[model samples]
Target: MFFHLNLLSVFRGVLYSDNSQGQDGVDIYGPIDGGTAFSGIQCKNRKLNLIDGSPNRISNIDVQSEIEKAKKFKPALKKLIIATSLPKDKAIEEFVRLQSMEHVKVGLFTIQICFWEFFERKIPEFETVYNWYVKNEGFHRIKQLSVTFKDGSVEMTYHPKFQKTVDRYIIPPTNNTAPDINPYTSSLANLLQSDINKMMQPGYNSIFRSTLLLSNTIDWEQLCWLELLVSNIGQAVVEDYKIELSLEGFFEKAEPERGNVLFNPDFHNDIKGYRNSNSHLYIEPRKKILVQGDSFVTGSFYIQPAIAVEAEIKLNWKLLSRDFTDSGTLIVKIVPQYHVIINRHEVLDSTDVREEISYSLIKRKGTYNIGSIDYHDKESDYPVS
Candidate 1:
């Protein structure tokens, strides 16, 4: 009705035709650019909640029915328009263009359809329509959720370890394209995009940049050179501490006879002391740090496993200061990365120069398997896995 009657005000001397039953698809009929013949419109109001990309609902079948109805009007329509509260779709556009071959007068040239996005942008009266929709039709208030860590540092301020909860609006779950869909995933995605956009700005906050990188990194070991940001998220200066990675039997010793097989004790003080899979570090209130063995290059300082293995590695740490002694444990799975080269010729008695690759070298690429998740006697003892 908004486009049927309300739009007629914008165009002078626009006529509206009504039948006895008053159920024809053509709602508004009038001269398009103030010439001779009449233009007809089929108004549609589709329920659009604007979630999951909110695809345009109108299809070719719906437009076909409208075209048939527009044919039955007393005087032939010079132009047919489909004005709806939905975006213009490719399927419907093609169908509209094909109808021109049906020999409707100047319809190929005069067909003027208003897509929902463009129409709403051009029409100021849509604000009133939307207001009415909010009042009468109502809207969903998406519940906000934050599974936050306990709001303090270990023994210094509050709890000794980080804690969180699984929070959501809906309790149950299902798999289907329904109206009552969960907005948690969509909301989180939007927040990530917002965070990324903020980071793109010049001289962004260090905390913001670290938070983005921390979420993506597999381990502190994966980010050796860079600081593993400590937002402190609390008001305490975390003293000297060490992250212990237990990779003794899993990794093959470089020098089988040597006592310190992993690190050359003479050269590196930090690397020499970390022979027992230890990474030395300290954390400050709202700052970042790089522990001893954290490395950008894989299998450099830390012990590299001989083969791929899924083992639960412990990251227990103790932060000791003059005022407070804070000790916590965070267990995580350490799985060896496997590199596979496909379509390669290796083993052979006849050594010859290979010219080109072939399908015979069909070695499959290894993927990250189901690494062991942390299992502990106490909750929050091992916060991450």
Candidate 2:
């Protein structure tokens, strides 16, 4: 956070590393007027311990000791500022003001105190520092949530449609003459498709109108079943933590995929009651404890999107813990499995011409049959009429 102040041309800050003669109470220093004079800052962390009920305060002796040490700093300091996380103390502020006046009268560096309130007020002036230091960065207490697939990929790309071979009895063949030929050709299609699937992470059936008829059913298993990894990237332990995940976009229903249910007997609550109809999934991890650098994996979930077409599923997650809270969003893209069945009437007996006609028909105005379809599993030996 101190580095943020370097933006001003009045001072160019550098970390005070000349500790061979000891730190002299100055954590950071910068030269003013071509090193003719110097300004220094001392940082002290004094946060009240909520868990132990211990009060952390900065007393007069603490300030005086640092001030005396600052006097020993080289280059003849002009100002010494103490920055601390201690709560505001009007008495301490007044004491520092009087000290500053006395030191100034004696030709010593002036002293000042910047309490927690000062930093809080300056947050607006330094948003980047505020975010990195308080909101979501720094080495302090923080919580982060991320999601991925079983393969440990943040993105999951899969087909939401599953193929189902239609019953041949529904559309019986009208003739049994020349053997039927499969018109579909495979040419590096699977290779290209494999590459497409890896871009984020990492199918065919038979004839009705002498063309080719295939059907695909909506597959919820493919759309949902996403893996979530909740990490406590902070340097503190978090307790009584619960994660809420809301799913949005192109989905009909969503529910946790079962398993990994963490029960806190002392809290008298299980992960079951956290469900809601708003496509929200909730999980309270084991013992409700998330420690520094530790992470837990939540159970996968499943959601059903609209049958066919394409789908984009977004998972927005928020983490609430005893000492820390954070929120983030994750995206899951889905390529709904589908097929195009073109209608082809007998035109020419030539095999190549018939195949070209089918391809042209599909490329132009093809018919789409979604949901459960009545298609014959086997193609007739001959074209019908």
**How far in Å is the alpha carbon of 384 misplaced in model 2?**
25
Mind giving the per-residue lDDT tens digits that candidate 1 earns over 1-385?
5445645543333545555666355777776556667778777776442222223377777877877777776577777777786666776677677676554464432345567676555544556655543443222212111111123212111111111122222322245544343222123355457767888899998875764644531221121111121222223332232222222223232111122424555432221232442343222222123222222211123332233344443333433322223345433344433222222233343344243422111121122224422211133223322
Give the winner by lDDT: 2
Give all candidates' CA lDDT scores.
Answer: 0.41, 0.58
Native-to-model Cα distance after best TM-score fit, residue 163 in candidate 2, in Å: 4.9
Off by over 4 Å in 2: 1-150, 163-223, 258-278, 339-385
Question: Which number leads on TM-score?
Answer: 2
Model 2 poorest ten-residue lDDT run: 356-365
Clash totals in order: 3, 2
lDDT of 2 by residue, 1-385 (tens): 3432422221246677544857787878887767788889887765343332345679899999999898888877999988887779888899999999999899999999988777666654655555655544342344454444446565676555432222111232458866343343222345345534544341221233223222222122334556566666656666766777777887678765443234433432223324348477776676676666776666556776655546788877766654345677777777754333333345333443333211110111123443323432222311221
Scanning candidate 1 in windows of ten residues, the lowest lDDT window is 155-164
TM-score, per-candidate, Cα-based: 0.32, 0.39
Instruction: List where candidate 1 sits over 4 angstroms from the true fold.
Output: 10-20, 32-35, 49-56, 104-110, 125-385
